[model samples]
Target chain A: MSSTLLRTTPALRGALRASGALKATGALSSASFVRGKATLPDLPYDYGALEPYISGKIMELHHKKHHQTYVNGLNSALETIAEAEGKGDLSKAASVAPLLNFHGGGHINHSLFWENLAPASREGGGEPDGALKKAIDSDFGSFDTFRKQMNTALAGIQGSGWAWLVKDKSAGTLNLVTRANQDPVTGPYVPLVGIDAWEHAYYLQYENRKAEYFEAIWNVINWKTVAARFEKS
Target chain B: MVSLNTVWQYLALQSPLQLHSTMMSGDSFNLIKMGVTTFALPALPYAYDALEPHISAQIMELHHGKHHQTYVTNLNKALESHIAAVAAGDVAAQIALQQVIKFNGGGHINHSLFWQNLAPAGSDETKLEQAKELVAAIERTWGGFDTFKNAFSTALLEIQGSGWGWLTREAGSGGGLRIVTTKDQDPVVGGDVVIFGVDMWEHAYYLQYMNGKAAYVENIWNVINWKTAEDRFLGRSEEKNEL
Candidate 1:
């Protein structure tokens, strides 16, 4: 939350200069100078707001502990890459690519996931309408069928993963797919709705009976945000 | 599709050292790697359908052939890359390679133990009498065999994500028995001797048990290779001499 935007803070710049990584040019916009650290975004609603479907405790833990860890991890991985780059250690920076991908995808996935959820009393639940609904019905046959297929995808994940409703960029159609672990939905697809299948996402409330949690989560899905994303994409 | 008995005969004659290393330490990677080595998917001793009615043939086929094989394959690739990185003094590459090695290496190690940790249900090897020393130790720790089983089951069920549950002997001259859990694919490290391990990952039982993890946990006992547990706990005299 501090005003410092660049990763090359005084201490790091000093360290780099001391290591002779920074030559006498003193260039400010060097490619090695990492810009803007990623920070945890504020939840659109209160943690307890999505209660009854997802418990207040679960939401608090998911947001404060789990999602925050991803944020921290993403920032840390980026910082490590920056540090390595500053020290002219491209091999070390490249080695951190997996951590960067995992943590970065986790952050993006959780951020999108939180935005697409709302209280049942608010814009949550019900079916998508307008162009989004029409696209779903066209691509997946119907809204009900799409939901069933997504839920099935959620259940069929072999291990920790995410089931996503993605917008195929070329076809402009909706498709359901699953990604193992924190792998983000990428490659010619823009993720619309991502349902985390990792046990930690629902374990405290659902335990091994994940299907119930899968069913309950629909009650709080914000189709409005999903529509906006669809429209934007 | 080798028969367990046939595999046992082959093991007794030609592969006792490999078997003993896998059963004793779950560190067969080091034992097999005298130089640069490519880890292979170990052949299942029993037929895929051998543990059927408890775990299905489909589950075994995929779990071993597909899932475990992927780990072995990836671990080999990662190790080769790591060797190159080390030669080039690529510190970043070596550091990055650490996680993949652990994940895949632990997968190979754990699955190797997991395969031998089980026998076909109702087999003589499943009987606790085959592991008398371990049972006595379990009783001393938890006061009864059923109690220890219950405790271990609780630990397995309570795992929040993909992981493994293990019964290990603390390292040292007179290490005691303990129940522990490792997240993801982390192996039982710190010199602890893994007597047995239960895979809690969904792939291990989802095809057979689905979300009924409790049922999977309960029935797993029916196939537990207690004799292997005994050998691990007792440090079998012959195996000890070989080591």
Candidate 2:
């Protein structure tokens, strides 16, 4: 609605489509952080802290071991790939491609996943205080409509990846998007919420049944933290 | 009368503590020999029979006793195996097991809370003040309650096979109520963090709604404790006061 909408960098725009003024993660979304270049941050809460929604066992495994593995593998791949490139062994680096994709993806995805995790009981998915709600209402005709749009977008994702609620900084509204594989949501938007679709992220207990898993997780989304993010960033 | 009393006393004597302890001592001996500790199912807050036709006693039995038990059993098994993996010097196996441990473990953990989230068969709430706040918020954002319901129902209606629909608040972008979905095994709390949500997985509704997801979602409207949800939504605001 304002003259500054689309020009606010991809970080401050509208839905990248059903989902708000989508904004992106600045250069973080576009740039590749090599193995040596990055680190997995320690969590504010203990591995067991998110219990009930995500068990202590799951958190321990997901963080200490699984995500750490990605970090370790990422470190290995980047150093090796860089060496290969130095020797002009293009083919060697080419062979190293999957390593980078897999490990790098693991690191990136897990890092993103951590920021999203928090105790919902305390946080309450932060309410949209003002403008975000207003825009959502105007664009989708109501907040409920926006939610429905996001749900449809998430349920539609096939295989592993993510569903995003982004502020399309350009359009200045929230939008829903499904990313294929570990493809980052790199458009002109900022991430507000991301739902992981990796089979490993769920499976096991849910078995081949994904719908049940989807249905159970609604109990824990933290709205309070989200609202704060909207206020500051 | 005296003879009958004597007879009852004699019958009680047959089942005395002395006899019971002597017999049960064998179980202690066996436990000492095997060194296994017992773990029992945690009791539910309400009786299984409490929530009647809305949620059948049979389903609660299976869900709590059978399904939940299986998770606990498997989790313990997985933990034991993980300890073995560490002892046997199989780092790779240990790492591999991590995924299953967490996934199954999380499944067990999440569902336990979920069972409590639902009302046991009987009745529901008016949610008075909370409903008024929520209704006002909805009206401000979407015009009225019907619009919000239609929109929310639309979300519940469109699950891709299995997942959850959340009314989450995201930070930095005004705390607008956002609806989002997550795939199988993926929890909003872990990856996206949900404040509260509706389970759209067929298990949540199959027994009740069958393939009619739309109908199941619509019916849920009657059950939602707006008061509970409102408290959660307002939870963060309370924290700000401390600062």
Query: Which portions of model 1 miss their true places by more than 4 Å?
Result: A1-32, B1-230, B233-243
> How well does candidate 2 match the true structure in TM-score terms?
0.40
Q: lDDT by residue for model 2 over A51-146, one digit each (tens)?
A: 565656556666676567666765566556656655668787668666655665556656656656677565524345576677567777886676
**Each candidate: RMSD:** 15.7, 24.9
**Candidate 2: interface RMSD in Å?**
11.9
TM-scores for every predicted model: 0.52, 0.40
Cα lDDT tens digits for candidate 2, B1-243: 012122122222222353244234543243223221122355665677554555546545666786557655765566566556544555566566555554445445445435534554324432435456656766787887788778877876644445567666565447676677665434444222234566665455544444345766766665454654665465532211111
Reference-based lDDT, residue B77, model 2: 69
Q: What is the number of residue pairs that collide in model 2?
A: 84
Residue A38 Cα positional deviation in candidate 1, in Å, after optimal superposition: 1.4
